[model samples]
Structures are given as structure tokens and as C-alpha cells.
Target: MSTKLALLPYAAPARYSRDERLRITRLAGALRLALNIHPGNGLVMVLGHGGEKNNLEALETWVQRSLEAQALPPNRASLQPLLAQLETYLTHWEADK
Candidate 1:
């Protein structure tokens, strides 16, 4: 028996639930702000040959920070601002459509 790992197609778009979308949207926005990255740039996933990506070092820093945040005691004060921002973005998204 042999074990193999298959690489999925790069162009495929995966489905995400509304909550999942909102969570990631907020995370990306916060990371962009923290790292001072332009709106046109900074994503971990490279969609194609010329896709944008966050600063590699900055992204690593974000990962470490997020993991650390999760490990700490729940603090609503820390998350409230991000949640508020997410709510504003989501509201605007609906209004735009």
C-alpha cells in the first residue's frame, strides 16, 4: 500500500458560511491595519502567478499573536472592537448590494 497526497486545483473557490466569511473578513482587515498593508495587497493564499500576499514576517507575527490570544482567558473587551468593525463591514456589504 502506498500513501499519496494530492494537490488540489489552484483556481477552485471553496464555499464558506456567512459566519465563517465574517470571521475571516475581520481577521484580514485587522491584520492589514496592524501591518499597515494596503487594501490591494496582503493575502496568504496566492490565487495565481501574480496574486498578492501579506508580508511573510508580518503574517507569521499575526499567527503567533492570534494563537496566543486564543490561549488566554476570554476577554470581551479585547474582542469588542474587532467585532464592532466586523459588524460595520457586514452592514455596509449588505447596503452595497
Candidate 2:
């Protein structure tokens, strides 16, 4: 039998200021564009590996370090929340394996 995954609902917290929400949205768009431009990036590979916990951990660590090194963009402070959102989004697909 085939199982269908339900779509995850996402609503930004009310505590986030309007500017913060806009920043998150912009960051998300940029990420989507980058992923589209480079289909074989590590993040895509990790997600395609069926949501293994270790893969997620490795990706998170790499991303955190990259952010700290200012290799990504914006700033670590701005990107942290987006990273959390990405984690939650990916975690929702864990059952697809």
C-alpha cells in the first residue's frame, strides 16, 4: 500500500517583526534559486538520501560553519532562523524513506 504524506503547515510566529518576516522570505527565495541553479548540491544530496539523521546532522554542521565563516551571505544572525525553518521542513520528509 502506498502512503501519502500530508503537507506541512507553516505559519510564522507573531513575535517576528514585519522586517524579520520579509528577510526570511527573501532568504528562502534566494535559497530556492541557488538550489535550482545547482541541482547536485550537498543539501539536495542529503535530502535525496531519504532523510537520514546523520546526513541531516552533517549538513547542519557544515551550514553552521559556513555561516560563521561568512561564506553564505547576509549574516549568521539572520540566517539562523531560516536554517531552523529548513530543518523543520526537511524533518517533515523523514517518513518518506
Candidate 3:
């Protein structure tokens, strides 16, 4: 018998749901360690290739909302600025639409 590991597609989108919220938290934590971004220092924001602000905002909202709903503890000192950014993005999203 041979054991094998299949790498998930990098471009695959995360499915949003209650269960997935836990997954996202883990994903963020892994990213923090992998990118060397300590919560105390700063948060990492990865802009996708050819990504526009609108699309970015939408993605941000998806992640932020899940975090808030789950009351996920901040790995950093604070998450206020990140929350504020998402709020601002939503405001403009409605105005632009």
C-alpha cells in the first residue's frame, strides 16, 4: 500500500458556512506563521493577481463576517482596524452599486 497526499488547488474558493468558519481561523493562523506576520506586529493582506478593490472588499467581508459571528479571539492585540476597513468597504459597496 502506498500513502499519498494530494495538494488542494490554490485557486479553489473557500465555501462559506458555520463549519467553514473554523477552517478559516486555522487557515489564517497558518498563514500568519507561514508569512512571518506576527499578530502583535501586523496583519497580512494578500491581494490576488488582477484583483480589483470591489472584489477584494467582497472577499474581506466574507472572512470578517465569519470571524465576528464566531467571536473568534484575535491572535493579535486588536482587530478593530481590520473590522473598520471591512465596514468602510461595505459602505462604499452599497454607494457604488
Candidate 4:
């Protein structure tokens, strides 16, 4: 005779925590950044309505803080591209000024 083991149903991974969500919301608010969570596209859109250099810097700082504080939840890899785009935009914007 053999012993039998039970199997459990698998569940989807958590994409974000409540605390992290709130933190992201607050940061976006403070930076005047608009966020669009598109489930269809699976993207957290950060629409920046142009601001001063310091404001962009602040956004970058906040993002870094989120990573450091372990506030980045699932699909966190997406943030890297966003940050890179932000930096590039800021650089060109500054250059144009």
C-alpha cells in the first residue's frame, strides 16, 4: 500500500499590496503624475503633465525610494523601463530648454 498526498489548487500571484498601492498613489499625487491602470494592456501608465526639472527628479527619487522600501509589488520589472523613459524625457526636455 502507498500513502496518498493531497494537491492544492494554484492561485494567481499578487500584483500589488494595499500599502504599496497607497504609496504609489501618494507619490503620483505629490508629483502631479496621473496613473492609468490598464488591465487590458497590463500597464501602469504614468502620464506626466510636464513640470520643472526638480519635479522630474522628485519622481525619480520617489521611484527609487519605493524599490528601496520594498514597496514595489508584482510586475515590478515594468518600472525599470518607465524610469528609463522618464530620464530620457527629462534629459531631452532640459536640453530643449
Scored by lDDT, the top model is: 2
Rate residue 29 of model 1 by lDDT: 53
The candidate 1 region of ten consecutive residues with least summed lDDT is 3-12
Error of 3 at 24 (Å): 0.9
- What does candidate 3's lDDT look like per residue over 30-75, in tens digits? 4344434434421222322234244333344344444554555433
Pairs with backbone N, CA or C atoms under 3 Å apart (clashes), candidate 2: none
Ordered from best to worst TM-score, the candidate numbers read 1, 4, 2, 3
Off by over 4 Å in 2: 1-14, 37-97
In model 3, which regions exceed 4 Å deviation?
1-15, 44-97
- Assess the local accuracy of residue 31 in candidate 3 as a C-alpha lDDT between 0 and 100: 39
> Which 10 consecutive positions of candidate 4 have the poorest summed lDDT?
41-50
Q: Is candidate 2 or candidate 3 better by lDDT?
A: 2
lDDT of 1 by residue, 28-67 (tens): 4564565455544333342112343444433333333443
TM-scores, all candidates, are 0.33, 0.31, 0.29, 0.31
Q: What is the lDDT of residue 79 in candidate 2?
A: 60
Highest TM-score: which candidate?
Answer: 1
Model 2 C-alpha lDDT per residue in residues 1-97, reported as the tens digit of each score: 3345443232222344566445544554454554342333545444323242444333433343334344354433556555655555455555455
Go through the candidates in order and give each one's C-alpha lDDT: 0.40, 0.44, 0.41, 0.41
Model 3 scores what on Cα lDDT? 0.41
